[model samples]
Target: MTSPDARMLASQNIVLILCGNKKDLDADREVTFLEASRFAQENELMFLETSALTGENVEEAFMQCARKILNKIESGELDPERMGSGIQYGDAALRQLRSPRRTQAPSAQECGC
Candidate 1:
């Protein structure tokens, strides 16, 4: 059963990572690594076994997510201008909005006073 937030994020084409934490306590783990990995594969999500106690794969997990997002953006699969969440707006959005290549104005234009 997927959470409503997960469904919402999935609908937005967001890259998802299924991290199995507490690798340091592997012996006491109820969920086997193979099981988690298989589940992640079935769900088409990146999987990582992380340990907060030892900080194992913690950085790598985040890096993987970032890399996937960057790859999607570079490949034009993700459009920052069209996305409504999970992305920060700054110079890139402004540049895209004011770009000479942009032929159409935004759908909802508001003049901030």
Candidate 2:
């Protein structure tokens, strides 16, 4: 989390997914599933094991990430209108109200999803 690259990627409230690659070679794994899962949990990232050859969990991973990103947008945790979030919504949605304290989660009504 302290790495500069990781910080940069997370700066815009971007959702992060951690995929452990090479699932087809489970016996030859460089990192175990449990270890990677623990790391993903500690880093607060969505976890998946994928195999390009087998096409395992690849689409599901993308779908899960997209779902969470949309949820973040709906929940007002992310603002695509803000610069550098790399997100855009086509339809008109009312912006979420900013709380003065910046501690409380915005209400669903407030977000206007």
Question: Which candidate gets the maximum TM-score versus the true structure?
Answer: 1
For residue 92, give model 2's deviation from the true position in Å. Answer: 7.8
TM-score for each predicted model, relative to the true structure:
0.70, 0.69
lDDT of 2: 0.76
For lDDT, the strongest prediction is: 2
- Positional deviation of residue 63's Cα in model 2 after best superposition, in angstroms: 0.6
List, residue by residue over 64-100, the lDDT tens digit for candidate 1: 9888776666666666667564554577545453233
CA-lDDT, candidates in order: 0.74, 0.76
Over 1-113, each residue of candidate 2 has an lDDT whose tens digit, in order, gives 32548757665676788888789997898888898888889877889999888999999999999888777776777777887676765666533332222567778778734
Candidate 2 TM-score over all chains jointly: 0.69
lDDT accuracy of residue 55 in candidate 2 = 98
By summed lDDT, which 10 consecutive residues of candidate 1 come out lowest?
94-103
